[model samples]
Target: MTFAPLDPVRLTADLIRCPSVTPAEGGALVLLQSVLKGAGFDCQRVDRNGIPNLFARWGEKGAAKTFGFNGHTDVVPVGDAAAWTHDPFGAEIVDGWLWGRGATDMKSGVAAFVAAAVDFVTQTPPDGAVILTITGDEEGAGRDGTRAILDWMEAQGEAMSVCLVGEPTCPDTLGDMMKIGRRGSMTGYFTAEGVQGHSAYPHRAKNPLHALVALLDRLTEWPLDGGTAHFDASTLQITTIDCGNPANNVIPARASATVNIRFNDAHTGNSLSDWLATHAEAVETETGVKIGLRCEISGESFVTPPGDFVALVADAVQAETGRRPDLSTSGGTSDARFVKNHCPVVEFGLVGRTMHQVDERVELAQIAALKAVYGRILARYFA
Candidate 1:
């Protein structure tokens, strides 16, 4: 028996209409669950801490050669709704482009893969398994989205041999690049405290702002490294610094700053945190101001070395688009960082030039082509 092929463009439109903004289900998961469940997938609504996620599999619980696809249904907020050419949630198609918030950043990617997987299993069931882990918290704090599903998978003894994440990886065009790894991401918050006093008094009070500036200068003055083979040089960017003193003549009691680090494979979050602490301590000791440091790690750097798996994805992309995709590690972190702990994972999808922007959109042809590429990957993986 043969089932009708899934229509990714239409599915993408349906998803966009739901307005599943970050941390909200918005019926996006419900639409996906209904479709997957009807196509013989074991669907589960893995909700955690008020966030919605969906896990669906077509095979045994612990298949040895399971192929997984990860993506997010939730999208970033659509700022300045009136500034949009098309309704942010309308999912309207104009001039062969789909316009919406998640069009490229990536409700379209998810729709393509889900369509491909559903059609593949219905028409040519793979010898192994196919799992889809879709989360709703990727655009938000992300504490209980994919991580929650991973925890549930562990408790249930479910696993994947290799996974692919459908996050708009293409930089300029479809099939132009694929991510084999990602740089680690961490952020540091700094607080420096001192006594408040009149600015006219020379030595009456310590100025915390001066100490904060010195520490920030120390952190950014030196390069983290030359560069890694798969990544560029690590970077520490001072995102913000503030001294909340209203009076012009007052030396504020407290000054604060924040720095975000995108580090390569050479350092872990802990190592960088220690590095930050050392500099912070020095500033405090020299200036007689108390320094407080708080660090949060979004993800650690990870790479899936070039081999059979990388070649498999590359071959599929080249076969469909005739473009030899670059195996890159340059990008902001994704849920793949969490999945890396469970299985070797990579990311590929549509062009991301307009993701999270005011007029976010995706090319109609690329959406169809993305589905074809995903279909090819599934066919070869099972063969």
Candidate 2:
């Protein structure tokens, strides 16, 4: 069968035209499904809880070897449309660059891999299968995005031996970096309750604000760890502190603060929760003030470690670009965190200097280069 080679840049431009904000289908997945289905791939609408997700497969299911690609079409809200020189949803090509919201955050990445997969299957027709898990909720709460697709795949006995997430992994250049793992992300919410009274009468009131500030100090002043081989030291950032009391002369009865932790393989979500709780308990014992703590773990730190699959991707990256890509876990959490649970997952793609920022764009050449790299990966993976 002869099929026209799908141009990734044109596909990316088409996707950028879709207004698929988080939690909205916005025709992005629809366009992909049409493209994939037209190319003899099996497609399914894996929408869950009203969040749109698409799952596509070529070749036999549960084959001896199945390579998968995961990406998201949903983009963060375009802030201040007037601040931009081009339409946020318009896939305008200016000076060898394609501009739009999802262009970098990852509509282009998706287009690259989709074009590669379609062309790979049509031309070479590998013995194994190819699966794509594209979600519409990566920029949102992420509850019903790839997680939901994985759940459905499990129930139906579908699986991918290894997955590559097409998130923007490079920092400065297209082939500079790739993620072998990501720091675990979790948020801790702390509330301190004490007696409320006038600020002038210090002895009459227990100030929760003071206790909360002191607790924050203990968490931030110290380092979580020196550093790991593939990961840096864990970081705890205080995102916010809230005390509703508006009166200048009153001590609030309750004050709360939130801290987020990006931890390394040295720790798990549970361990960090325990760490936060221990500090709150010590502060309570010392200050004689009641403290409440709650923690939510978005993802736990994980690494694929340098091995066979890692080499395949790194080799492909180096083959395309003259430089060897660094295998470092320096970014925030990604859908790869969830894919890690199912299979050996790695992240690789475009440079992400402007992701989620106004006038998000991708270099036209990088999009073409990324497709070639992915094409190389597929050829090597199924060789």
Candidate 3:
């Protein structure tokens, strides 16, 4: 079969046009399937709970030396539309930059890898499988996204030896950084209960707002950990504090506060949850108010360590851009956390300076360079 060179720039534009905000298919997956199927690849829709996903494979399933690429089609909300200088979904390229939501956060990353893989298999047709697992739910509640596909793969006995996640990892320039792992992410919610009363009669009511504030102070002010070898210090941030009572003259019956934590390998979600519960108890005892705590773990800290997979990707980045990429674990959680359980995984992609911002954009040249880097990784991996 004849295979045309995949164009990351054009592919990225088509993806951005879909408006596939979290949980929405936005036609992104369909476009990919069309091209993939035409290239003699086997494709399947791994949709779960209404969230769309695409699982495509070239060569035999469960084959040795299978190389996988993981990424998302869904992007975050466009935020305030009025502030943008370009159409959020226009996929317009101006002055060499492609402007649109998901341009960097990573529609472009997906394009680079897909393009590379298609060209590789059509031209070389690797002895092992090349798998692309893309999900439409990464920017939203991630439970039904990559995790769902892994579950399906497990049931079917499918596996990949090494997986590369195409998340934008470079902070300043392309080939500057690649993530070997990511910090864990979790959120804690606290609700303080008290009697409602008028502000003039302070003694008649317990102030739940005071209790909630105390709880937040305790959590935010206390440090979680100093730092790790490959990661920075774990930190907790107070995200929101709210009381529905708008009246200045009345004390609310209940007040709530939420905190988000980005933890390193020094802590686990279980340990942090226990710590939050203990602090909640202390706040309740000190403020004479009842408090309830709820917690959710988005993902846990994980690393692939420096190994063959890491070296393969880092060498590719260095070869393309002439700069050795830093092996980092500084970013927030990603789908790689889940993929780690299935196979050794690492992340490398274009520079992500404007992801999720109003005028999110990517340099057109970077997209092509990224495709080149990915192509090199594939060529060498299947050699």
TM-score of each: 0.99, 0.99, 0.96
lDDT for each residue of candidate 2 in 1-383, tens digit (9 for 90 to 100):
69999999999999999999888899999999999999999999999999999999999989989999999999999999999879998899999999999999899999999999999999999999999999999999999999999999999999999999999999999899999999999999999999999899979999998898889999988899987988999999999999987799998899999999999989999999999999999999888789999999999999999999999999999999877999989988999999999999999999999999998988999999999999999999999
Error of 2 at 167 (Å): 0.4
Instruction: Judge candidate 3 at residue 96 and give its lDDT.
Output: 97
Tell how far residue 258 is off in model 3, in angstroms.
0.8
**lDDT accuracy of residue 300 in candidate 3:** 93
Instruction: Give the alpha carbon lDDT tens digit for every residue of 276-335 in model 3.
Output: 999899989998999999999999999889987799889999999998999999978889
Candidate 2 global lDDT? 0.95
Give lDDT tens digits, candidate 1, residues 1-383. 66899999999999999889988899999999999999999999999999999999998877778999999999999999999999999999999999999999889999999999999999998888999999999999889999999999999998989999999998887999999999999999999998899999949999999999999999988899988888999999999999877899999999999999999999999999999999999999999999999999999999999999999999999999999999999989999999999999999999999999999999989999999999999999989
Assess the local accuracy of residue 167 in candidate 2 as a C-alpha lDDT between 0 and 100.
96
Which portions of model 3 miss their true places by more than 4 Å?
A: 198-201
Residue-level error in angstroms, candidate 3, position 101 = 1.9
> In terms of TM-score, which candidate is stronger, 2 or 3?
2
